[model samples]
Target: MTKGLPMRRNTILLAIGVCAVFGAIGLFALHMSSTSVRASGLMPYQDARAIELGKTLYEEYCASCHSTNLEGEPNWRDRDDDGYLPAPPHDPSGHTWHHPDQQLFMITKYGTEKMVGDGYKSRMIGFKDSLSDTEILSALAYIKSTWPPGIIARHNKINGN
Candidate 1:
């Protein structure tokens, strides 16, 4: 047994302990992070700033089809010459409020063809390339923010409150 053998053992033990402590701290940091839009990784809509940015996105990308006032096309329910459905309103009167927030996010992110199926067709393309996930959520937030209190409450219930 060398005189330094005991010291080496203590040094190894201390290094291991430090590594363990750091690992535990990393896990705690991940757990403590609150940037998640929701528990399920969806968007949080109540932020006023996000809602404002969303309004801009809606005007630039969505207003063409869904209408500037969020009223949608005149014959939204009826199929056009190509038999594709028109963009529906985002207001409480429209079916957009009928779906949960996550579903809404998916539709906006992936577009109708991917979300609905191969057979479905629509002019509303996915904003995945043009906009970030945060932007999509922001636009959705603006849409939801415009709804009436009753509709908003109903949407909250749909989102599991």
Candidate 2:
């Protein structure tokens, strides 16, 4: 009976290993399908030169509070006893990547107030009164270009085109 115990234990281990492998394979398959299609709908100025122009615009118009590298401010995730984040990072570590392009564009154009309802307020100034639509789109293009391939792929999937 003791000898048979060893065989039973081996069988249990094998089952667990097979389950783990199948779970891993399923996850990978989902990820692959999610990124299969790239976004086709895009801003007009999406070329390399536009991305460069966007970088300059970001530095000039967005750098003060958002930071030069879009890193935002110190303690960006922490509230100043007022329940507001200092300024979130534009990098992948922050929520910037999670938003779809249209939402980001709207936020830039109309400020957070238009999107988040009347009561909400943010330091972000609306570019609608100052920047043209083309310029705004270019700025977004530049930011997207900075993201890693995987992040971009995921964003494309989220856009569903």
Candidate 3:
């Protein structure tokens, strides 16, 4: 019995070490899956084709107001002389990442005034008439793709991914 004691202890320690290793691997996998772009909700921002198309569409439709670099007009938070807010930046510096994917999609399709209602004033017009839903999503994906990994992870959390 005394001779087997050390062997038994070694076996127990090995088992515990194996369990710990597997647990760490499982946790890492879970974190990766949760933070992945596909799990972030909405379109696949990782698709290169979609991102390319989105860039084209953004330049054609969004660049005038939002700027080609996603930078909004100067003093974007302030209302213009006409009492309408300038277009906000789509970059990390702006509040666009604060909203979840669905809200962003709806706002893109229906415009801000429609979403806000109650006599709210916004210069943003709906793109439903001009751009297809997929197009809108692609544009949004492109915008999201531009965000850094940390922002992407935070946005994923916001989307409950």
Give the top-scoring candidate (TM-score).
3
**lDDT: which candidate is best?**
3
Across 110-159, the per-residue lDDT of candidate 1 in tens digits comes to 67666555355667788888988789999998998898889988878766
Q: List per-prediction Cα lDDT, in the order shown.
A: 0.73, 0.67, 0.76
Which lDDT value does model 2 have at 115? 45
TM-score of each: 0.73, 0.69, 0.74
Residue runs of model 2 more than 4 Å from their true location after superposition: 1-40, 43-46, 81-83
Model 2 per-residue lDDT tens digits across residues 62-145: 887888888888977444676454776787876676665665666677676444543554566679898887788888888888
By lDDT: ranked, best first: 3, 1, 2
Give the winner by TM-score: 2 or 3: 3
